[model samples]
Target: MDLESFLLGAVYYYGLFIGLSNFEFDWNTGRVFTSKRSTLYAIGTDSCISVLYIYYWTGNANIVDAIFGKANLLHEYIVVIMTGLRITTGLFTLIHRWYQRCKMMDLTAKVVRMYMARPQVKRMSRWGILIKFISGSVTDGLQMAIILNTMGRVEPQFFLGLGLQYWISVILNMAMVQQYMIMLFVRTQFQLLNSELRQVMEETKEVQLNRRHQGVFMTRCCSLADQLEDIARIQDELQTIVNQLEKVFAIRAAMIYGGYYLSSVGTSYLAYSILKHGYENMNMTLSTVILVFCWCFFYYLDGLLNLYGMLHVQDDYREMMQILGERTLFVGLDVRLDEAFENLNLQLIRNPLEIKVVELYDVTRRSTLAMIGNLITHSIFLIQYDMEHF
Candidate 1:
């Protein structure tokens, strides 16, 4: 019911862990306050980890030596590209979150106020959060085991690279999950708005039906109009929330999607090369295969969930529009009702709700399918090249 009640579920801990946010929240006052100590810690930790990751990889010439005897150009390049993506994304998340910390705090305050205003809305589900946390932990553990088994004795550089890679990966993954969860929260708000509108519509129809037998017909109509206006205002606020969150996440969303594509292609190619070369150490080969497969599985699921969350918000918007259209038809010939219906329709039309990635392109079903198609096509090309070459 309150911000603190749900913050523990996912946002707060992940933010603290990944340096996404370092602000303290006052639940009673719905205030988000930041301290110099927390800010310095977030900045220092993120910067040090990033510098260490870069330093470790830059001088290390044996990156692929653990997996391949001779350097496979493609595999090495893929590692470089993937590492670059991870670092770029990790740094961007940290920097951008800091740059937008004030705006984010304001948005958090808005969300808290919205929730306070509507206690009927469902609180964040700790069960879902627990399941996700457990799943991620298990996946990370499996990845570490597989990598250690394949690479054998973890040299300092190898350990450093692997540890840093895991750090960046965790940061990006947590950011992705947080964005998805916030969008889900917004979708729920839209849903609640639609439900309230439906109730008002039903009540209006009942009042109309009893108009002949009742004396407070005009009074009831006026009350319904007030309810409609209140719902409109809520919808407007929800839209603002969506837009503000978009600013917070647009670039990161694009980077995350791009990271997924690169990961899938790189992993697919690695699997092909491993198969072709047929490493003499059977255990190493098997471990490498499992490691690649596990990474692919987690990335695939992460991308799917993000895409679904975006699409679901779009679906809710469409449903809200449909309900508004229905209400328009039943508004009769009253000038006030007509204006209200027209204004709501026009507002939706002019400023439609859209979840965008990269700040320019809207994430729709068609676009998402196309993205998947492109990923598959690229993976196939890379796999074919690996077969013919390495």
Candidate 2:
């Protein structure tokens, strides 16, 4: 096989490796959302292999017509075989991704419902939720566009490999977005809870003056404070994970894309240098072989780099999951209210002034609720409007 043909095949194998790797990771993480992207990547790589085969056959035909009397029968057969393989692979991958997308949509809806049902979260946070959803959707759309463009242009044998690069990029980006949003929500919820707790502490001072409820109230306040501290620590760890992911992505981008382009340019220059030296004995076939070999080597290297990057992204996500799991465990533990509120003063009052507290609470709750409602409604409306316009 010619250099180009060999390179194309190598890229196809590289894509196969990526697909298998992603499948394993997804299965381990229970993240079926990645399966569709992985399938598309495999298909794209397969397409690249087919395109390269066609190019190699065409090149061989031209060479035969120029020198020999007939085209090579083997080359023609290889081209037909590659074309069939490409079509089949592409079709299967497409179907798989489509199915996966539907499943992800359903899962996202369920997650949204669960989030909405959380009583501790303020309604105002809905605005942030909506923003995150919109941003995530936009990011996914951009990623699909990138994949289509890359896959549509790659040579046959190498088609899926190039597409796999974009697939990894899209997945990593989405994961980063999700982690960031989760961190944001965690912080917001902590703040809201803290504020409410402080207000409760202040209001209960008068109630404690005469009420038997002083001990319970004080215990609850201390327990809330402990929960807040635990959440804050988890948030810190999440931020660390986010930072690590960003750094990993930057290094991977440099190594994969930068290295590929640099190597391609260097190899092309080297080929040109050989030609410029007037090496008449070098022949076109030998030069073509060298060029094809170099291209294939570079394609394989790129795939390896992408795989490493993906592993790093997954590691960061796993760390975040660990932190969240730990936080949940801590939250589940019983608080020692007797010990926490032991030093607190509790006063009981016989006839405390009403001070129209109920009216005040009603007005404040109504205004806050209305504000939250407006914010959520406006964000949803804006998202809808943008979707229609786009």
Candidate 3:
């Protein structure tokens, strides 16, 4: 384990803390309403999940002996392994938060820079936080209700059997909230940079007079260059933070998303079996269906929002470059701003600031939209095969 991971182990994670301490946290008066409650929930859920893990680990359990005994041996094994992964991810996220807090440079200054500069950014951050909290609560509550309702029909301890699934979803939900916050942070910083760049360029243009003001123009150019460098440094720092986050979340994302895709396929294959078995229990099958769709919707919406925010940030950067290029047209003053602009542009272009999952694919609008369709196609094939076989 790295120093960070070791440090994380030594510290206790209250509610799987996604170390928001690095950001603008006001511990004095700012209260996290759900923190305490969620910690209790985490403790309870872990207790139940631990029992399942022990069962599987000690060979006291097998695929066919798992909950419901409905799925094939391979399917059951995959579910258990994935569940373990999900729990581990939730804990790691907390550990990561602590590590980032202790070892990394504080991001409160960077986050505050944006919040102070843009009212809209502040408004958006509030709305983003509100949305994540509400949606996360509603989805987890609904899923737990559905699972308990579905399985409670047959077994009273059904909820305990799926405790891992519930908390895993919660952890993933919280992680995505962190991702969204980072995206917002980057966008705001870029927006600030873009605005400042335009202002500087315009000022330079206004100061540009016929030949005699060469020194004044040079001074203005130099000032613009300094500002650009400062903003670029922040932008680079933001990118570094994002790359680090991607590395941290990559495996978790892969497991979560891969599990989503597999569930899509599983639902397709199992729908017929469920319908047949549940013909008399319409409520049960319907709840199961709703639960699956809920998960899909959650993953789809979260992915889209994150992708949109990132693309928006990049678009803002492109617009800044365009403005710089246009302003350079009539500039006969000095070459410093032009050179600085070129250098910054090159850096931006080289980085491109794209997000990815396990370096698998660029997180883009087209790619995200395609995945939904891919799920549909793959699900249909699986359903068709099951229909033929059974």
Candidate 4:
């Protein structure tokens, strides 16, 4: 199957598993198929699942675990808070998907068309997807198995609850992967567009070099105008896709980033505790610590991959803007060509296609570094507090 088919198929099946959707997508065409009855049923099921999930976790572990419990390890509280944040983020993502399903479908269609137009550049292979799937499955499965085995005599109800939790986590993780792929696809289109523009600019300069006949020069200028108009139209569509992507993904991205921060702080604390005090001091075994850190390594790696993917989008947009700036506007070119260039430049300025988190800030290198700085600061403060108090 093609990349789009594989990606959408995974989303459709995973959505069904999580009650995120009941819609079907064509394997070849990327068309969404759904009916009122199915959508209503899916919504009802999703609501029930949400209610059940919240209820299960609420009674399973309360906030008191962090504050009043006898086992007040520094990471115990962090784990509790991480669980809450992850569940909240998952719920938000599910609801957001339902709310923005139409736009997602539209965006998918546009992206699929772009893929079809340039199949040669579709470099993603099925093996890449399979490897990712296997790696995540193995890591999370091992972690869950370790937890269950450590508990001793896991009941069916508890196992099912954990299973549901696993499903939610997997879906949320896949959502990040999907968002990264979307950005990758957009970046590819931008590259193609920039290449085309560069070629046109070269041709324009070549025509300028050999401008012996007035008729030939005028004809070439008109052709340049048409090419600019076409590129501008494509650029406009890409901008729309980028906007819709932000609308569909911004809140989820913010939530995921919050989840990442929590996970990082929590896991870092756990690793620190294990290292500083030893697992025996915390009533944990070496194996448990090893497994926890192993799982966390993969999880953090996934988050970093998505974060870097967002950074690449910003990088590519900058490159495109530079390419546009290099365009030497030929004198006496059609007025329409000047207008197209002006319009394109204005759009780029106004609606820069940078991956943003809820319209608050662009995910640039500086912002990411600042976030890491804050994470380190918070972690150090927590470690010091634990040293003095606990």
Candidate 5:
């Protein structure tokens, strides 16, 4: 609906990747637009119905069978849902409560936006945009190829019926990528702040001194202190957003981790069964591979995003403030930048960004390694169980 003017599809798909929607939120009005909802509903209904009808009419096996330990189809649908959920919940936490996350980040982004207006930053940003675009396109192309290629055996009319679902999936995938990319870019912008502040200090140190210079130096230090105060506010807001997201992530972690465990372990079981049972069908094997790929792709992507956006930023931020405080300007602030920086540093240390899945486990590199270890162990157990019992 009015796709050209509004980025309607992208925004709506972006919404769904968090909770579910293909609509525009008017920040001013606080309303989600309904222009395309009817169309989306029609298509979604058709896709779901087509899958069911195809199962009955064409005798296609239940997709869930393959999901548990079989392989009737690839990740074409599952990734669309899982990754959408990952991004959906993420964006929800950010955008909910009146754009809480966006508003908080926007303060720092405002500063970085000025810095980014510099020629070098603009050029790098343009290139970064291009590379990200190309990389995402390539990834989708591969995913589409696998899905359509594997779907070739399906009846033509039935296959064609689900085209809109697939189209939306690609759009949603792109949106999901966009969300994480923006999240990462925001962190990078903050990092740029670190460099920018340090440069200002360096420049101040380089200037030669006179009586007038002392006056100028004090004025600049006062200005720096003011900026640090704003940054202190930013740190506070960012911590609030992180705390809320941690709770959201905690709920999400359970679903994602359980999904990975089931899909990974089940796909492995099915693959072994295929080889052992000698179901020489290429479709089965191809689907299994795609399923496994989906599990790994979203699972690891989720980890990396959290690692960089949440974990790394926590440490780097605290350290940045510490170093900034050690600067001569902050050391001599009449109002005491030291206390502000110290409080910010202590807050960050006390509440390092963390993502806990259902209060069960925190997402970290160590946890990731352990998850893999456990998955492998469980897969082995599944194999042994099948061999002994079946």
Candidate 6:
């Protein structure tokens, strides 16, 4: 009814909209990683805080009415119910996040197993898993703290302070996550190059065994080595991107936390000023309404700022995933069969010079034909094999 209460309601509903919108957008975009569960917790806690504000204001109104003999119990009861719902919502969010974390861990384990099969690229996979675990744990801890504080009836100032701390922690953790991902990508590139190098070395061994093949083998090895070197160069560029991300996160964290503290202090001072000077003209209802609006406005601003940070973090994560997805090698049957046949031919060709060239050629041609037929048959076998495994 008053302007302040109306604004408080607007702020609360607006925050609800923003929070829900973010949840829906992230879910659709597939950016909901393990850390996102914590975000849902945060949104729930914020909604609870808003409800608490409403309850506090409504109670204050009832107290004023009792003293002045003006009835406002209906409003007070409505707000109390809202408070209860908010608390329940917060509890549900906590449980949801806990369940999601467990599921995420299970998925992560599966991913690690898949990565280990890479053998050459296992180190990068391990690093990625480690970083994700650390980041997820820290985020979940922070969210838990917020849930406890809300349920335990913490003072508003202390709650805001803790929220700011969590924000800083989240930003830093995200930065570390990004850095780890870049390192993982670098490691993957190295693994690929290492595998290429091993192949080149095997070719070099063939050249060593037969001095006549030295020039051709050396040229191919050199070309492959050059490609590996180029990959290294690209990794260096990726490292530079990681460095830039670190700097951006550091600066952004400082600004965000700094702004949060400054805003809190400013809001507190503003409330104090209004309470001290406006008492003569303002009724208790008006004062309570003003306080509610102030709290809600501060929360709204904090949510917006956090949303910005999350968007940045999510953008980087999506970019990294996109890159990784693109790099996934699609080992076609044709390619694999060609490689297998080539290896087989190379091994068979290393025979004694007493073998006639014509006989060797005939053997090579026949072997090639046999290999082609076998590959087609085996390709069909693999389809059945995969179906059975699935």
Whose TM-score is greatest here?
1
The Cα local distance difference test for each model comes to 0.72, 0.39, 0.60, 0.71, 0.50, 0.39
Candidate 5 differs from the real structure by a C-alpha RMSD in angstroms, to one decimal, of: 7.6
Output the better candidate (1/4) by lDDT.
1
lDDT of 4 by residue, 1-390 (tens): 666456546655765655665565563575666777668877887787688887776675443332223445556767768877887888877788878888877877887776766664456434434545555556567657655654553444465455566666866777876776677667677777888888877887787688889888878778887887888787888778878888888888888888898778777777677677776766666676677777787877777766766677677778878877865556655566667767777878987776677989778899989989999998888888888987
TM-score of every candidate: 0.88, 0.30, 0.71, 0.85, 0.61, 0.31
Give Cα distance to truth, residue 125, candidate 5, Å.
5.7
Model 5 C-alpha lDDT per residue in residues 19-111, reported as the tens digit of each score: 333333443233433456643653464355335534544555433333223323332344344445543443333334233334423433443
Per-residue CA lDDT of model 6 for 264-320, tens digit only, reads: 443343344345445333233453444445444544343333433333333433343
Model 4 CA deviation exceeding 4 Å by range? 2-8, 36-41, 44-48, 58-73, 117-121, 124-157, 329-339
Q: In angstroms, give how far residue 314 of model 5 lies from its true place.
A: 3.9
Which candidate gets the maximum lDDT versus the true structure? Answer: 1
- Writing each residue's lDDT as its tens digit, candidate 3 over 1-390 gives 443223222222422442322222332233223355544554555455556655645653332243446544444444565566666666555445544543222444444454555445544355555555456556667767765765655544344446555655666665665666667667766777778878877776676654466676677778878887886786787777667666756766676666666665665555655565553332335556677667657655665576677778768767866876775466565677777777877777788677788998776668867987998898777656656654
For model 1, the superposed segments whose C-alpha errors exceed 4 Å read 1-10, 124-139, 143-151, 213-215, 279-285, 331-335
Error of 1 at 110 (Å): 1.8
lDDT of 3: 0.60
Can you write out model 1's per-residue Cα lDDT over 1-390, one digit (the tens) per residue? 444355444556666766666676764567778888777878888788868866876784575665454547787788788878877898888878877888888888888788678755545434434444555665666666665675474455577677676777777777877776567667778878788888877887787567773447767777777877888888899899989988888788788778888987887776666677654532245556666677678667656766776788789899988887776446443456556667888889999998787677778989878877988899898877876875
Off by over 4 Å in 6: 1-127, 146-153, 156-161, 218-236, 239-390
After TM-score superposition, what is the CA distance of residue 232 in candidate 3 from its true location, in Å?
1.8
Q: Candidate order by TM-score, highest to lowest? A: 1, 4, 3, 5, 6, 2
Candidate 2 Cα lDDT to native: 0.39
Q: 3 or 5: which has the higher TM-score? A: 3
Looking at candidate 2, what is the lDDT of residue 22? 27
